[model samples]
Target: MGNTLKSVYDAKDNLKDYHVRAALQEDKGKGTTLMSWGLQDFTEKGDHYISVISGLVVRYGKGNSQIDETYIVKLSAPQVTKALRDMVAQGNKKEILFYRELLPAMNSELKKVGLNPLLTPQCLYANQDSENSVLILRDLCSRNFRKFPGKSCLDISHTRLILQELARFHSSSLLLKAAQGPQFVAKYDFLDKEWYNVTEDAIAFFITLFDGNIENGVAILKVLEGDKRTIRWLQTIKHNVYKILEEMMKERHSLHHCVARGLSGYDEYGNPIEAILLDFQIVRRASLVTDLHLLLNISVSGTDRKNNLENFLQLYYSSFKQVFDAAGLQVPFQFHELFQEYENKIMFGTLWALAVIPMIVSGGEPSEWASSHHRAASEEATGKQRESIDSKISSKHGELRARFLPIFDELIDQGIIH
Candidate 1:
């Protein structure tokens, strides 16, 4: 162990004494975190990292624009009252295993990749003594990310950036698993059928919430509710939706109709200088591309332009190229091959957009799903901060559409959709 830095502050105060000496990255106030999102089963809505059971609040801060010298962490009271261990004890093994194995193991891997351990701050802390397991994170802003915080139509450039990052992150993990073999295997247990059962239920709940453009909305709903349908065409919906999710829970795993062309070249610095990953809560043995597709669709739904789709693919291909080369592996998969394989996967992204757009797009005002994250974000996201989220989304409407449509068309061209 190394010497700990000393600062006079309460364990739960947001003053200082929060730097992780080993973290390879630091936040300069890059992004914002909201507490609620519809109905999260784990229920982190009103508190940034609340333990529903523990009722103890662990306050952490990060900025993409600042280094450790300005970093802060605090310990505080919980927004809700629940026992952390009590909930853990009642939860199924896979949920527990996610926190116990995958989260910690993935954090360790991020550090190995020479980045901050908590790449996305999903949950990367464990203070067993105080019975407070929370996160102390380096913000996602450190990278030039295009994770359009609020309602973004889909900027081609931003979409591409996200795709590239996913490609890099996914392939990077694949390379690590390839290299580490048993060690990596030992760290992650396969998410079993039970996990899928839980996810299916959660997704079903969201599908019921779709209230968009009526005909389109109904079409989306019909697809979401196609579980028991025996129709042949419905099979396409089932295959595109449920089947993919099932396979994802099991293991490998998009694109659009816009017919996006791979750019001749891209910003080299945009490549994986280092890996920054997301959603450890769902980090099962899956095609990392599936996650990328889901997020991209969720992010850019209804945006007219599809080159954003092409841009997204480029992001994936380029980021992946960078990481594979750095890992000293000959980049084996061509970008087009991976794109073709993932074409249908884009529907998941659209599905996500259906659910998330209503909640996050407006920026400051409360939407249908606001209560989910609003109560939780009070600890970190102020009203002013939330208002600013709109600005991030507002400035990019044209660009987002320009970039998003091509991705959609590309998916259609690949014959990934019926």
Candidate 2:
């Protein structure tokens, strides 16, 4: 084993030699020795110290009958800066809680409706400690699961599959809540807090991405500052974004209202197959439209999103309705009503795009933009970092500008923004 994997195994006293031998004996009816193991790192080079993700493939079995199993391990980052330790600790806690508690409850609901369980990797072990947190899960790649490319825009067919799966995710939460009651929902109340770390500095960072030119940035900031409604909304979000997100979550009964994934493949007909949702670190109970808006705006190309916006919304609603009907639940909102709800939630998409597009387009790493203390400071360090982020945004100004201009225009035209 590599040093990291060895460190992980060593950190947990339960994984000592005798226990491994006993477990192997239990699995194969005789003691088997671990033949060999290899590790591959999957951790992204980001600034935050959430955790390090790695794949560990092990060969073990009784003599002459060896087998290989691949597992993904999540371990807390080593030597993290004090500024980000709490956020990292919280993320680790939530993910461990998600796998240990939430997944089983959710799968139980899916089984009741005779549907397959949610598409998350199977968790083998989870332990939470601020200093030594670790989660081991089935490696989806071992099951032929592929992640959607992060650097490219999603095509229409891929977009459709994502929408369908998102609908099922939201529908599943509603079904679970309806069947089990608020107490069942309350078990996931850990998600009641604001998951996304949006802050004023983040907002300011994104504002610099608009129009790519200083003149356009100045104009947009002027409009944003001068508009009373916009000002109030930002102020409200700054103070109570999590509470607002909690209310939205309660309203929709959504399970994974954040970045999620599952296995992806194509059918024989070449159509995209539905993907399962995974990664619950930042999962929240929020507006169903929140997921839809973020995915459509960030993943799909601007022109395709513009052309198919209404169709995609309808598709999401239809999928949601179908799942509810299958579970013998009434579709709570009419199509027009849902459309209005979508309109009301347009700000989420706008805000998310503004905050996310710069990173996506410029390939910038996440920083302490989510930190309140960082936001409060106007030091030379913050100024230098802001300039670096702006320079990165300026590098991809044309592409980023194209993607966002139309989105802003529509928000303005619809009277969603002043």
Candidate 3:
């Protein structure tokens, strides 16, 4: 539980930001818990704070949840620091902005629209001076499911529900923008937020983290890094991963994909259910197709990938186009054209995943992540925080090659990846 903070910082690197000023020690109040095993990769290190893990908690609703009224609760935590106290003495905008302004604003909007299913946390509290911040919100351990990086594959039913809702959510936002105007729209803006705690320094940070192998991922990144034709493609594009998602929503071509996404009984149950969108961390504005492409590129099961590329791609396009026709929005580009663009970017995902995925695959024993913090208390820990270096190591590059190469092969066959 104590070491959880380290794991969180390891994946995110941002938590360590405020942790700089050491507060000897103070009793931080009890927090909440979210789902631990969202994805099954042994390499992916998850948030700490788990005590005991029992695989996936597949059953949805259970006892009364304590986090938020709108969504089922899972894991949560709070951090207190001496620096935070001094800041309270100084009065900082960073304090009120996150605690007072952002979350409450989102909650108010969701309530007004009568849309309560969005699992985003309602803001809890942030002390301006102490820099002490506590985010009290609902966690989605049992309710939400996570789909991780894989190539072309049939969308799983749980993920499909999320994808459909993603379209609807974007449409709703656009509709709200139409009715309320741009000023009203800015309140819900997640545009400026950082993802995976990756900021501009991430490129350099990667250099430090990978040491030797940074070149491997860099090779792919430099493909555009030097291609001044695209300007600072990775530099710019990587930063706006969230906005790019909204772009996907904007480029959405059809509602049929959303409808059909709901049709498949692809989850644990054989019945269709609304997609459960996990990880609101990267939720933001983009062309609708961007989400489709990201979802296509990042999630998807390999078994499904190998067996169903053609049909899956067909389903994605047909259903997506159906929705757009109803909305009177021309798809940004033809599906084939989109594939060509994606083919060029396939290595982007591969390279990034290469660095992280091995850690996930070899992360350690599959267990429940009982809290939102990072490391579980019961496990061994040292320094900031790190998974026990695996006894049987897994090479991240190798796993990526296995997963990505097949897709690259297909793209080559289809003449997509140039």
Highest-TM-score candidate: 2
lDDT of 2 at 115: 82
lDDT of 2 by residue, 1-418 (tens): 0022223333333223443333334445565677766556553333123455666666796667889776766666543233344554566677778788877877787788778777667776677654457676767775556666665678888888778877877787778777778686577777764323434433343333221222223233343333445444344445343344444445544665555333476666656676756556767666677788778776777789889988998998898888777778789778887778777777666666655554555543434223223333356644555565556555665676566555666666787556
* Off by more than 4 A, model 2: 1-36, 42-49, 78-83, 193-252, 260-263, 267-271, 368-376
lDDT of each: 0.38, 0.60, 0.35
Sort all candidates by TM-score, best to worst: 2, 1, 3
In the order shown, the candidates' Cα RMSDs to the true structure are 12.8, 6.5, 12.3
Number of the candidate with higher TM-score, 2 or 3: 2
Candidate 1: regions farther than 4 A off = 1-124, 127-133, 139-148, 190-216, 219-244, 247-279, 301-305, 362-418
Give residue 348's error in model 1 in angstroms.
2.4
Cα lDDT tens digits, model 1, 193-275, are 23223444334322322322112223332333322222233334531454544544343431111101111122356543332
lDDT of 3 at 309: 48
lDDT for model 2, please. 0.60
Question: How many clashes in candidate 2?
Answer: 3
* Number of the predicted model whose lDDT against the real structure is largest: 2
Report the lDDT of model 2 for residue 74.
61
Task: Predict model 3's lDDT versus the native.
Answer: 0.35
Which stretches of candidate 3 lie above 4 Å from their native place?
A: 1-155, 173-190, 193-203, 206-272, 287-290, 313-341, 364-418
| TM-score for candidate 3, residues paired by index | 0.47
In model 2, where is the ten-residue run with the lowest total lDDT? 1-10
